[model samples]
Target: SAIYLWRFGSIKSRILTVCQHFFFISFRARPLVQTFTSWKAPIIWEEMFDSILYDQGHTDKNSSVALTVFAVGRYLDAYLKTFLTSAEQHFMLGLPVTYYVFTDSPEKVPNITLASRRNINIVQVEKHTRWQDISMMRMRTISETIESEIRHKFHYVFCFDVDQEFKGRFGSEALGDSVALLHAHYYKLPKAQFTYDRNPKSKAFMETGDFYYHAAIFGGLWQNVKHLVDACYLGIIEDKLNNVEALWHDESHLNKYFWIHKPSKLLSPEYCWDQSIWDKRDILITRLVWAPKHYETLRSG
Candidate 1:
């Protein structure tokens, strides 16, 4: 009887110990694992990023900024004017800005009176018949020009579509080694639903991705931007060689590059809002991107 009681007590104690270990894993360890894997949490949290990150007073005084845009034909000229004027009014107000306007006819670039310490540098390039070609061409053009003109002149550069107008402060919160904007349409969507290039033959193909980054606005440190451009340009060349083009052209290439090399900072959909497509209550529109115009009519001479 004594032996039976002792053995039973030992078994009970071991069972209790096992229960405690299981409880710790179920209650404590599981949450830690989930926290690490949560996709909603940005790699660079919003609280840690702000204008002060790039403020000259806090860091270097000689830091300069360049804004790059391709306003290829007459149709985009009107939008470019609004983009430039609004940028002058709200973009890095105190910092030195050089607008590198890539256009077929540089003379058509609006003669806007830029703010203090701001200037425009028009870069002429041959025009392509298709808008898609022009978009892809921008990657090669920017990569080439940055080597010659922009790299020596600026510390940081921002590549923006000519269709957006700054409604609020597009300040230093955006500055980083490599910055990418979450697509306004797909930021809340699941990874499976993201419109990444799915064709295995294409260089931009990705079976899974973290975010559907918008190609409309992307830039960072000069070296980082240059690296991104070079990669996209090469990806396009490889896709062409294979007789396959990514579904979204340069945008797909940009997404693939950013997926393999995560951006240092990711801007919320607020950075690229289309008022016509999204509800105001759902998104805070920091910049208003005009709705897509009919290319046939808009691009006509």
Candidate 2:
């Protein structure tokens, strides 16, 4: 009887020991795991940034050539700052760049320059059409403004929407001499998007075809844009003949021409990613820069 009792007690004690061991292990790891996680973020961010800088060749001439923006009333402050910041970081390094602002309200923009060099040129565009006419008249206005004011003098002209902030180098190293296009979230959708997707070479996903780059925002060489604007003019006229209004105005026409002709290369999505494009975690390590004030420096000194 005593032997039996002793054996039962031994078994019970052994079970308790195992439970205690597990509890102790988990307890000891809790703070360590937290520390490791905390330390991991900076390392990841540094590595990702290094990769981007390396890929961009870290040179001024190799960086983006120029920046062109289209803005309206009461929004020029933020847009100009974003443009100036980008020019400071990338173009001012060595690339001869210009920030051409086409707006009726150019005088309202703050005069921010990179390294005391005059970096801004504000072109006053007549606001003949209301904001509601964004689809047709606004597009023509922008095109005509570029034709008249820009004269296609810039090597690269980014017709950025006033609201966006540029995150990556908009230079030759990032995209080479070829045209660079930003892949929009709606790229896959037909009615909602304008770019092509069907691959001429692939047999898989034939129903959807191979995706072709259709459009870009915040980046593109001026040479391609001149051609694209010409094509868009022709396409828009054709659309009028058929009475089909484009989904996103001239942007759609630009996508269609680029898709058919494949005149541009696809830029890394990280370059112009908005909040909707990636989650917080993905954005945390990215050197993603933008305006409109949603994100700030996460780490404080």
Candidate 3:
């Protein structure tokens, strides 16, 4: 009888210990599951951004879109021909388009015969010795140009790097009141891992953020684009005043603006991809960005 009682007590104690351990694990896992469920990935889904089904023909007739690029020196001119030709072929095929080419040597711009509705306006800008200066200067030039020229001429504007080539259709489906592209490298990482300007002294600094947007591609309504450029230019000026430059120059400021302002539409990495470095299984190539030349050689005249 004594042996039976002892065995029964041991069994009961073991059962109670198992129950406590199971309950503790369940309790711990509950919050983790909630956190994952509540967290929203910044990626915009295909159904939301698909341009094929959108009535682009109707929108094209009514919209005037401007594409802006800054190719300041000789090295980038090699890329200009392909960039211009592809854009003519695939970008908003029937829309009234203007290519605002900001460059030091306007004559170097290819004399490609654009479609009747498409045209290139070469705006001469003073050449800068450093590519970094050119990158930062782009915002000031874009803001001033929009105030003086682009605002009255176009309904929408897109800014892109001159080094890229368009491999597939980059169409009106990308259009938005405000649009920003996720950086190809950091799109999948947690916000903590995003490469934002971390310096507290810089205006672009962010302790936490939702997306690390690429400055290479961004656009919106004339007003929104203007606001974006103006804000970035001002941020740069503030950094200059503080005697600190943000880590990635203009890109840092861009991420800062969109983090606070949150773009109305977010483009997937498919919009801007470095094909040479990445052969991502999930990414369908809409545009293929070429690897850039050596910074010193590319920027030097």
Candidate 4:
């Protein structure tokens, strides 16, 4: 109507069309947010994918998936159960999945029932006094484990923080040579505003880069993922030797790695969302969301 009024209708009709357009905008539904990175990797958003096709492709090949999570010290009691249970319900339903749970308290690990081809392995690990060490050391631990056995068994591996729950489908649409999840908090911000470590002396320092990736979720083919974690762990160790630390610990080093070696696929902020941060009008479907921050309580637990 606006086009017709502007092209053929009288002046008064054109004026009315403009007013009507503004009135209708209040009822507008969200539009699709579909795009790709400059390096030709897709940014998977809800409106941009065919889940069934991706699922079928992997299923027919009989590919197996592996999930890794750390629930050391306080987090074992705080967030592990909810994370594991929700994952059982929504993560890669039709595929064979093995969950590698790293925890200080193996007996406390949740007894979530699994489907036909699903299993869990409890790996007891040392609990660090500082939460930061617990988070940073995961890169070293995961890389070592992958080299030891996971590389031979799993087709793909995904590492996630125990402090989140699955809210929707997180399936084979995410499969790639290398996959990175855009940080929910920084995805919308410009590169200059991204919280990359600016310290020149640190190994994780970044002068400029693409989207900042979340430390909560990262994965890919076992080999690619191993390479990523190996590189990140090396950077972390180098920083410590030089008496410096990345601003965001492992997350900072992850960002630096991605900036240099672009990921083959990218998951939108919808993959790792946080409701408390901002509006959700931008996100059409949320797959997983951050469990509320209980830093003081969880750390002390």
lDDT of 3 by residue, 1-301 (tens): 0100000011113222332111111112222111111122123323233343333433534778989998877745667887888888778777889999998888778898899889999998998876446656899899888889888889889998888878777776666667788787887678888988999999999898877889889998888898999898888888877788898988998998988776766677777887664547646455546545657766665
Q: How far does residue 80 in candidate 1 sit from its true spot (Å)?
A: 1.3
1 or 4: which has the higher lDDT?
A: 4
Best by TM-score: 4
What C-alpha lDDT values do all the predictions have? 0.71, 0.44, 0.71, 0.79
In model 3, residue pairs whose N, Cα or C atoms come closer than 3 Å (at least 3 residues apart or on different chains), thus clashing, are none
Candidates' TM-scores? 0.80, 0.58, 0.80, 0.87
* Model 2 local distance difference test score: 0.44
Residue 67 displacement (Å), model 2: 2.1
> How many clashes show up per model?
0, 14, 0, 0
Off by over 4 Å in 3: 1-52, 57-61, 291-301
Global CA lDDT computed for model 4: 0.79
lDDT by residue for model 1 (34-97), tens: 2111322222222333345345431344667889998877655557788888888888777889
Q: Write the per-residue lDDT of candidate 4 for residues 82-147, one digit (tens) a residue.
A: 898999989998999999999889998878888999999898888888644665579878988888
